[model samples]
Target: MRMRITRRGGLVGLAAVAALLVGASPASAAPGDASAYAAKIQVTLLGQPAVTAGPFAEAKADGPTANSLATVHLPGILDTGVLNASASRDDQTGAVQSKASTADVRLTVLGALGAEGAGTRQGVGNNTVGAQLIEAECHATQQGVAGSTKLVGVDLGSLGSVDATPAANTTIQVSALGVDVARIVFNEQIHNADGSLTVNAVHVTLLGGVLGSIGSGDVILSSATCGPAGLPIPMASGAGLWLGLGLLGIAAAPAAVVINRRRRPASALAAEAD
Candidate 1:
């Protein structure tokens, strides 16, 4: 006898297997800065795909520590969203201080065929999804220290589905001591299934004048599906099904063989009695 599986049943089974393989962790707050007069930021996801939506934000600062200036959450089948932070600190002599800001902060999710599959094929629908930080600024001033850094035309990170070509671009600029240190830009041309794509840019400016010095920088971080909260396993057709079951120690062949052997033994015993 042959066994048949429905699409919905198969998906549920696959999801269960994925949960067992990847496990699940409760969401927690983002960590604080390691040093005084420093700024820190983080993103977290709440639940698994097709179940919960998230990518929450928790930001903090010290020594003129900044507050969560603004935050946006775009939860979906998978957790996704962004956070921003801004703060300023100054010294008694006014010779030392720091000001910083982060924007377009977000998390992303993408789907791809499992390694066991033959040709490469992305998941259907919106396989690429993420948030962005339109801009960020960090400025520091110190006396007697003269240094500069710059980043321009560099790829910070990418968002959107693998099935569609990205149609967005991102760029960054950093400067110090009256000189351009870096000018970086990242351009993407992937097509989006929903025909929606956006660009993000971060600009940093640092100045060290006469006996004073300054520093500034920006960054774009990303993960496979969820954010720092943890890696949430994603589901797709073809290889995804087998991969999930295999990881859970329930390979199709062994299970099928066990069932067949059990049925054969019962039938053989009945025939011998007759």
Candidate 2:
């Protein structure tokens, strides 16, 4: 048995599909900044800022550009060389990617000088981190997101020990006099409530009052954030709008033609047939 679909019914179905294309786009729905930072350091005394290094190597999708910085030092506290950050976005596809990197990092602390005479050193030869978000338009999770971090010659030193390749969000802390003194987190990743993603290659913080208003600092390295945004929405002007209009017209064409032909007189149809 053969089943025939009426022209009106097919047209209605096509119209519905066009409506979906114009009204909804799941992959590129979220909105947020795609950004990255290479490194920074801040020290506070009793919660007041004292020394600062940089939030320098930074990138953002506002301009969809990359940036870098070279050789930063704060004697006895921080030293680093060669930092880079970059971000890119496809406006038509609504895809974004971000990255950050750093080399020759060393953070030192003297218990006597600031740790109240406790010696500690945090070190790393080089590191890189990256994140990407693509629209889930065509495939299910494939090419949708990519994230990773790499580190070489890491010396946790007194900051706390860890495997060369630490797991995500690996943490270490130092305490004294039954109070927390310092903390470090490695390879951290977070998912925002707004459906965005953030990655931090390293984070360090030192609380004040280790030896009466002595040590206080906060630092971050190789950080990136990106929107889980997806494919472009079609409701706006240009190609998307034209595409929608074209689909609607095609769908309505058969139905309109069938209705008009049915209303014409049988003699007119016979004359055409003759």
Candidate 3:
């Protein structure tokens, strides 16, 4: 019963698997979806002029939905004050939700190295037999003046569960006087196969990193997408409407009381046979 689409990011099945990730895709959408965005910078090389910037302050929603977005800037690379993504569904009772969030985060690349954040969030929720996942970790910080190092999220969900369905990629390697020079990512969940869900919190894989030319890339921040928990009520499609209303109250409630006493009249059956 709530719908919004201005802070759009995880647009349907994670932009159809992010246009196939470096190349991704998987969006046909169903189960009332949700979306949000705060940043997306895609640069390319090989030929050049392919420096697409932004997916900023984006939002999307459908059916029982939700979405939110606040500020964003892409001067050096990225900046955020608040960005939230959401996906929703009520489906008569089988609730659902999907979300992504960001706040006071900043980034700066090429001008040095890049990474910073005061916040970041990811989500996934479901009902009608169980499904749950929502995180507010990811308070990363790497502006240590000599490069960054301060992470918290990514403990494999307390070292036990794992249900991001088919998507969960997190990596960050940006070193300097020590060596390693690129690769940064932070993904949340994605259980799409129709049961929609796509969260790409942040991803940057510019093909121009280290070599291969100079520009040809990727960047996405605070993305969110929702579910596909198949809903139709009646205990989710079964019991045949409570066994056809208990055989229509045990065989039609006495054939309507003997057809209302044969429709009366015949002088009320000859005045009850006087």
List per-candidate RMSD values in Å: 24.5, 9.3, 21.9
The candidate maximizing TM-score is 2
> How many Å off is the CA of 5 in candidate 2?
28
lDDT (10s digit) by residue, model 3, range 1-274? 0122211221332433333331111122223444555566775444435557666555554532444556666544455566655445555533345455565554444323322221223431110011122222111011100101112232221112333322356565434334444455556444567545566655656434454234336666666654444334332123444444444444444444445656988899799889
Task: Mark the regions of model 2 whose C-alpha exceeds 4 Å error after superposition.
Answer: 1-32, 46-49, 109-146, 158-160, 176-179, 209-213, 233-274
Q: Poorest 10 consecutive residues of model 1 by lDDT?
A: 222-231
- For candidate 2, lDDT tens digit of each residue in 1-274? 0113355548565776765565555444643458887877777645445877677777888863788888667655566778788877776667777888777766553231233223333323222111111000001121455455567666544444555445767787655555667666777767778666777777767766635355776777778878765665655455655666667677676666667778999999899889
Cα lDDT of all candidates, in order?
0.28, 0.60, 0.43
What residue pairs are clashing in model 2? Answer: 27-230, 28-230, 28-231, 111-115, 111-116, 111-117, 111-118, 112-117
Per-residue lDDT tens digits for candidate 1, residues 1-274, read 2343333344555665765444432122222121111112121212222222221222223432433434434332122223333333332222221222233332222111110111121321233222322332222232221111122222222221221112233433323233443332332222223321112222212222321122122222220010111112233334554556554454444455546656887679689669
Per-model TM-score on C-alpha atoms: 0.21, 0.63, 0.34
- Please give me the total number of clashing residue pairs in predicted model 1: 31
Candidate achieving the largest lDDT:
2
